[model samples]
Target: MPAATFEPPAHRGLLTESIARRLQNEIRSGAIPVGAKLPSERELAVQFGASRNVLREVLRRLEAQHLIEVAPGRGSFVIDQSTADARSYDALYRAGRPTVRQLIEARIPIEVEIVGLATSRATDVQIEAMRTANAAMIAATDPVVKARADLEFHDTIAAAAGNPVLRIMLSSIGGMMFEMMLRSNSDPSIAEPGVPHHPEILEAITARDTDRARHHMREHLSLALRTYGPDLDLSLDVMAANHIETLLHRRSTP
Candidate 1:
């Protein structure tokens, strides 16, 4: 591996962001080999002319992007890149800043396929995990928790894909999509309380019936599209926030 070099960003107001970008550039350029241990926070702070707090924040940001992992009593290490993994995929997702519609469109193809794959690949343990996630979703009363469980359930299917790369891609999109859905659908009460498709999807996968898995996936997505979808009428609140009210107000005046 090469000695890591820092690439300056266009702007550098925050020390943490600057540090993160520099580190990210180094990783992408192969200066820092995957799975390499990073310098200590104190050393990094001294090297970057930043405080320990600043360096730690920078590390946190990278960890969130899955570029690095910090272990307690151990140290921060660059995530291994050898196997097809979620790190780069997660970093790409974080870099894109996707919107609700973009996320949904991205999810459709991957999710539809994941179900079919799960039917073939799912093990008994994985099936039990999916059931646990389903139960969590049902037990959740808050939108955020429900959204998380919903994402986890989908992730379970992707994990069953038995392909690390595919699973990474699925999880990257699923994590961000979860947050986006929660934010966009601020009202938890708009649709039904919990995930409605989990049981059907689970049953299909458990039975090893690919057609049934695909059918259930389609049915679920169709319902999701109709419910929390990005259509103009998804919610009055979204409309109000987006100035549809002002447009309607103008139309009525004319």
Candidate 2:
């Protein structure tokens, strides 16, 4: 017997990138946890209405980022997110430095979905743990303390997902996620007492309403993203400008 050759699909539409974006977003959001097998290239192509080639290219890019791995005689497996291979896992955001838009946009969807899943799977003990973490967040006066507490809250929810692989995937970039939250929450709006939304999310999860859990989690994220301060780091844009300026500065310098 001989092995079957891999056949590329025949269609590549302008929508290929959009499909890729949706898939990547899903992976980051933990709708597809780490170490889970993705659909075959042919299946993905059909699903996205693109050619196999485009789907393969998208998977290749994700693989390059260590978001997925392909093996001969097998299918693509999301890298074991639990591995925490710094060399392999790239934090979705660079810590202490990310655009306000980037921070909020990236963090919201992922956390929202995690809460939704948690609503269904979290044990009573898990719910209580999250409440404890939230209490810590509410009591903290310093940025560092608040940040740690916030991480605890989200980490607890991720743990409640009942998937160790999902926790690992969430953990890989978990540090950066908290850092971004702190940065975005520098505004007075977030600093006010009773403003943190973790409690609302925990309440929803305890109530076991997946829809409410998702909604509150999203509201929490939306508030963070919508809130802003003059101190918001525009460094993302600054760095881009500086890179060009430095290149020109060097070009002009005697």
Q: Which candidate has the highest TM-score of all? A: 1
Indicate the residue-level lDDT of 124 in model 2. Answer: 92
For candidate 1, lDDT tens digit of each residue in 40-125? 99899779766666677788877876678899988988786544564566555544544445556777788888888888988999
Give the whole-model CA lDDT for all candidates, comma-separated. 0.65, 0.64
- List residue ranges in candidate 2 displaced over 4 A: 1-98, 184-186, 193-196, 229-254
Give candidate 1's error at residue 244 in angstroms.
20
Which ranges of candidate 1 are over 4 A from the true structure?
1-63, 66-91, 94-97, 181-190, 229-254
Q: How many residue pairs clash in all the candidates, one count each? A: 0, 2
Kindly provide the TM-score of model 2 when superposed on the true structure, using C-alpha atoms: 0.53
| Candidate No. with top lDDT | 1
Model 1 scores a TM of 0.54
lDDT of 2 by residue, 78-116 (tens): 765445662344433543457656655766777777888
